[model samples]
Target: MSVVTEPKLISGNANKPLAQSIARRMSMHRGMSVGLVDARVERFNDQEIFVEVYENVRGEDMFIIQPTSNPANDNLMELLIITDALKRSSADRITAVIPYFGYARQDRRTKARTPISAKLVANLLTEAGVDRILTLDLHAAQIQGFFDIPVDNLYASPVFALDILHHFRGQLDDVMVVSPDVGGVARARELAKRIGAPLSIVDKRREKAGEVAGMTVIGDVSGKKCIIVDDICDTAGTLCKAAEVLMEAGATEVHAYISHGVLSGPAVERITNSVMKSLVITDSIEPTEAVKTARNIRIVPTAPMFAQAILNTWSGTSVSSLFETDTLVPIYEGMYSRD
Candidate 1:
């Protein structure tokens, strides 16, 4: 553990409640509120963002909380401006605490001439003056290498996995861990191992943009309770389809454990109509009213884990043991009554 002195707390206009929650959990007071010049965001006709940090942040260790969720461009820009503001203010360290990192799904160019937006987002953040980055549950693991600075790709698996294990107790056997797509097999496997469950894969193909329906099952799901896992459920298109496929493939129950519920567009309606028994998502991103009130959708919090991470980081402690070994081993150890 490296000694980090004089860490500061600076937050953007995104996910204020979650920021406050994290700060509260850390048992720290907000150094100073970054106020706006104008209460109403009255912008010029050009639609350019206007930003001003009212408080001074000179020589501070600054941590900015912003979830680049809906209105991604705006929220992302706000984060950048906050970072730039902190950097210009001579903050000793500027850590961007983004709970939900947007544009992470496009890590590679799937088609000819397509942009690798994930890399672009990383470059943009780096260019925007983020000294180090702390985020949760990136869609792709390799995105950590995209940043030159020390990047912390936190996992929501522990939070969700532990919660599911406690909720379902001994009814875990015959439960299948499912990856909605092939890309998420590693993450799904981790969660599956944690819960002491077998694994399954959903072979899916996207028909068109903003549409995801399942095609076939790659593993046996007969007479099993299926928990479909994915990093982000943007429109619930893929998850809805996966649940339907699992249920159709003789799965007794089809549940989805997603980390971030961006749930844009018709996501709420889609999940409402899907055959899934329940949809578990984290509060990494804020939930809309429809999502909040939805009966099937449940939110697990990442605050405790993230709060612990922040405290551990500030305290020069090693959090490397956090889900370091295959999450499944310890999970199954707890299962089967094994030490």
Candidate 2:
């Protein structure tokens, strides 16, 4: 008989609530004691990150849950330090669970003499001794190739689909899934298929970052409710502009569903004054006070999906089943029993 090892969960200062939620779900559903590893992560007098694991992790499977969200540099440094600590402690396997990978948007250099920062971050983690990586909805799917170790990219489509159904409740006939840009058509199309809706693309031209030159709706959205889908919503510039264009093109109602809500800068203010009815996002990144107070923003919990993925990874089971379900209730029931 093969022996199954329970993986220990750990968290840094970045998004601790999400880490706790994942750990709690795993313990409740798997009928086992899945506890967070005790650790101290703080900055020194000069703001240098320090990490120390209190519990013995020697020869133990460990998963560190930390998202490179706000204060990106600080959080990223903390993750690297945490991974190094785990390695020195002799952990059998270390998986860096980054729900929202920062610098992922810089996957490739678009201009002359620019750097591919995404690859640099991947190299940093690998060098820090992370045995594997588990992230959600990378900005560019090709970013997975940047890492040398095993990378499992989870999706937020399942969570978003469930919320859409419950919110609309059998009245999705006139609903349409829209891609905010040509590059995101694949992601939008997949979500549209899951919800049994048609797909539309926003043909947009960007002159530079956080600036939209022009946008046009490619498909017929006349008198239909539209849901713009994308992997990340950084500045809300493109999304807000796209929503305005959709409304002008005769969309009855406009909404957005994105995997990561990196709502930086004036995103909250922009969304509040835009035509989008609501901007639904997954809890991959911790929301700011502005996001929480925004009347047009709703957050969908992704803990259930992440919890099952962790279990599957520890047990060497396929984690792809998580994307096949519209709702997460069955996954929360421990669908792949280890008995």
Candidate 3:
């Protein structure tokens, strides 16, 4: 029989608070004191990255929590360097827990001569010695095919579903889930199914990135409370525009629940000025001060879900079961009830 090692957790500079939260949840799950691995990830004078592991990881299972969010290149480099360091140190296996996968939007080429950067990132991670991948809702599900290693692509819908239930208690009859664009209908449909709500899609034409030329609502959102669901909200343009169309279609109110809040550029400002009633996002990427102070923006913690995922991965259990709404409702309800 082989020895089973307790998973060792480590993190890069991308989102330390989220890493710490996951560690705390893991400790609770194990019913013992579990601490993060003592490691140093820093930058050199010339902006080069450096990683040094203080503890011995020989034959140990290691998990690195890093989201390649803002300053994507630097964080991605840090994850690669940390994986390389752990590999050289003889860790038995390394799993990268990327809450927000940067460059994922570039999974395919819309035109000739453009590089598929997501595939390139996958190659880099594989070459750097990642044994597996644990990530939340990727921008495109097909991006999972870019990797050779086993990848557990988790969903934020369960968590969002629980939140919607809590906020819309006794109001489900008024709720309707909206997909901001045609491509996101599937994601929106999943949430709609979970909440037992009708689904609507916003058919839009995008001339280019960050610009929505025009849009039309594809369903009867009239007199209904609309909840837009999406994977990433970078500039918030699509979401804000979708909200406008929904309200014009007679939606009583509009809200959004997004997986990765990549609120870059004027995203926060746009959200503030938009007609949407609220914007709910997971803490996949660290929130900026502007995001924190936004009146209608709320962050739902994802640490508990990710912590459970890590525990399941370490024990060689079925991670896909966590995706079921029946399995997640009680888990998340217990977690948020304390708050």
Q: By TM-score, who's the top model here?
A: 3
TM-score of predicted structure 2 = 0.95
Q: 2 or 3, which is superior by TM-score?
A: 3
Point out the higher-scoring one by lDDT: 1 or 3. 3
Relative to the true structure, candidate 1 reaches a TM of 0.87
List TM-scores for all candidates, in order. Answer: 0.87, 0.95, 0.97
208 Cα displacement, candidate 2 (Å): 2.5
CA error at residue 321 for candidate 1, angstroms: 3.0
Candidate 1 worst ten-residue window by lDDT: 33-42
lDDT values for all models:
0.76, 0.89, 0.92
Which ranking of candidates, highest TM-score first? 3, 2, 1
- Which candidate number maximizes lDDT? 3
In model 2, what lDDT does residue 73 have?
Answer: 95
Encode model 1's per-residue lDDT on 1-339: one tens digit a residue. 333444445566667677766766555323434322121222457877666666666666678878898888888988887777667867667778899998888898889999999889999999988888889988888899988988888887776677677777778876889988787899999888877789889987777886664478999999998998888887787778778778888999998888899898899999998898899998888888999999899987666566666656666676554554343334233432222
Task: Report the C-alpha lDDT of model 3 over 175-252, residue by residue, as the tens digit.
Answer: 999988888888999999988999989999978876778998898999999999999998888889889889999999
Please provide, for model 2 over 51-144, each residue's C-alpha lDDT reduced to its tens digit, 9 standing for 90 to 100. Answer: 8899988888889999999899999999999999999988889999999999998999899999999999999999999999999999999999
Model with the higher TM-score, candidate 1 or 3: 3
